[model samples]
Target: MSKSATIYRMVMDGHICPWGLKSLHVLRSNGFAVDDRWLATRSETDAFKEQHGVTTTPQVFIDGQRIGGHDDLLRYLGKPVRDPEALTYAPVVAIFAMAAFMALAAHWVVAGTLFSVLAAEWFIAFSMCLLALQKLRDVESFATQFLGYDLLAQRWVPYARLYPWLEGLAGVLMIAGALHWLSVPVALFIGSIGAVSVFYAVYIQKRELKCACVGGNSNVPLGFVSLTENLMMIAMALWMVAKPQLL
Candidate 1:
């Protein structure tokens, strides 16, 4: 077999190891065969350790040369490391699209049809919230596996819960406003809350913190996309505040 075709051994300790699992998946995705026999056994680990003087699991060896961990393997595979700046435009586009869609829907559709739009918005917001919560959970799992710590995991649950609930409430308020029973103030309130959340995400990203907005899927640093999203939400709030009749 060719060198690249040779089955490589990856030694991993726990199933919860993100780096190991990610590396294994990436390797396999890149067409490298990984030998799972080296996962979490003293005998397998000891043999590799004696040969390479490595004490940790997630050891990668190719033709008997130690290749270190995930980062190293990623480098070896020549995959472009994630760059936050590169992803800035995507959020901006998404926000603009959302704003345009909502505006068109509100304008073209009468008040009677608003309920259907509100329902769609409710489902979307709920879905986004669920995705965010799931991402937060994955982040917790990742932190625990890598750092042997669960501090963020404990704190994230409560803080994260508020977002979905607020989003769902906003959807409800939109529906109520559409029914002409509630004033524009309710829709404004909901939009304001969303704007605040997006702005805060922007602030966090500006400070170089990773955004947990969409959860683990968000690799892009919060910047223009977040800011734009916030501004759009605020604009929507203002529109709703100004025109309760449209709702």
Candidate 2:
């Protein structure tokens, strides 16, 4: 036998309760025949709330038992609740994903081919620019968080402030394919410093800290992702230095 559920929600001109619609959809999708009841006016909604002893719309009932609102329905349906404050790799993943996609697009436009060493160069360059932009968004916050584990930043506070600008400059120069003399040195120096700092902070000291790689306000952890980002910079710097001789 198909189960049945009652969903009471607001449905007026220019004022449809979205949660109520979602509740009805969930019930229907879950093999339940939904008894959709609409509160068509302010008084109707108010009276419905008062009569049901509830304060909100989009209330659901299963087997004559109240299932509350959207969140309550989710809980009853066994869905995981996502907390906004939770730590995640989403920021770093987005940075790398977008950088790689942009690099490929640039490569295809300029060279007319997806296969080239320049693609890798562009990827690293775009990654640096994007990452630096995140940091530059809130330099003070980034520097404060960076100083917690970065050896150079802790020793010389001003370096923390300068790091994002330096990175941004290097990225721009690399992207423009100009002034390798300046950009290579900057990339090499900062990449080396970052690699050493991340290594000691994560491996040796074994401290669990937030990574300022994306920005000071980010929730990325100080671990493999941070390490890989620095390594990529170092490799790019080395390639830029050697590309002339190789050609």
Candidate 3:
């Protein structure tokens, strides 16, 4: 068996190929000797592709057998594939994680302590603020997508546009520990509406649609995760209303 590999990759002065560099790195890291062949011009690159009958760049050959391109090389080495289009809960997880950390930090700064019921309140409030900010980044797009599932947004078109700002205001007020009368009712109303809408859309209607939660472009499904988000808001609202003693 041959222990050597040759890579045909584009490497012009102004345009260095990323996959070519990756291929070289992978080969070297795996203790394989590499014959570096640079297609330095468009004509040379075209000719190389034509000769190999492959459509893409950074072609690798090991022991005179075609081992294919960058992704193929990773597969050959038994590495995990990182598909860009793969759906994940990573974004929501990251957002909540950051919100929790921020809540703890804020609590520590204000009260000179860590982790209390107030800290939990702050966490939810911060999460709401962050989520609202994400939606507000492109409110028009968010409103357009939200109309697909949100019952209120469907009837009152202006509600979709106003929703993010309302969420943000309620969150900010909660963080300030002020205007409970306004914030509590706002949170309860919105959260209740959101929960019912999500339930009806996912369970009753059985619609397979992307959630406008997080952002308009998010791939998050309109289901349990979304319902949980709304439920959290409702719980927070109720907690605020019932816990005047805690305050």
- Scored by lDDT, the top model is 2
Give lDDT per model, in order: 0.49, 0.92, 0.90
Pairwise TM-score winner, candidates 1 and 3: 3
lDDT digits (tens) for residues 1-247 of candidate 2 = 9899998999999989888888888888889998899999999999998999999988999999998998898899998666666778999999999999999999999999986899989999999999999999999999999999888889999999999999999999999999999999999999999999999999999998889999986778899999999999899999988899999
List the RMSD of every prediction in angstroms.
8.7, 3.7, 3.1
Cα error of candidate 3 at position 240, Å:
2.8
Q: In model 1, which regions exceed 4 Å deviation?
A: 4-36, 82-164, 175-187, 190-222, 238-247
Give the alpha carbon lDDT tens digit for every residue of 163-240 in model 1: 434444544455444532342343355345545554554454334443444444455454555444335434544555
Q: Candidate 2: how many backbone clashes?
A: 1
Clashes of each: 0, 1, 0
Please estimate how well model 1 matches the true structure, expressed as its whole-model Cα lDDT: 0.49
- lDDT (Cα, tens digit) per residue for candidate 3, span 1-247: 4479999999998999999999999999998889999999999999988988999999999888999999999999899877876666777888899999999998999899988989999999999999899899999988988999999989999999998988898899998989999999999888999999999999999998888888787777788988988898899899988898765
Q: Please, what's the RMSD in Å of model 3?
A: 3.1
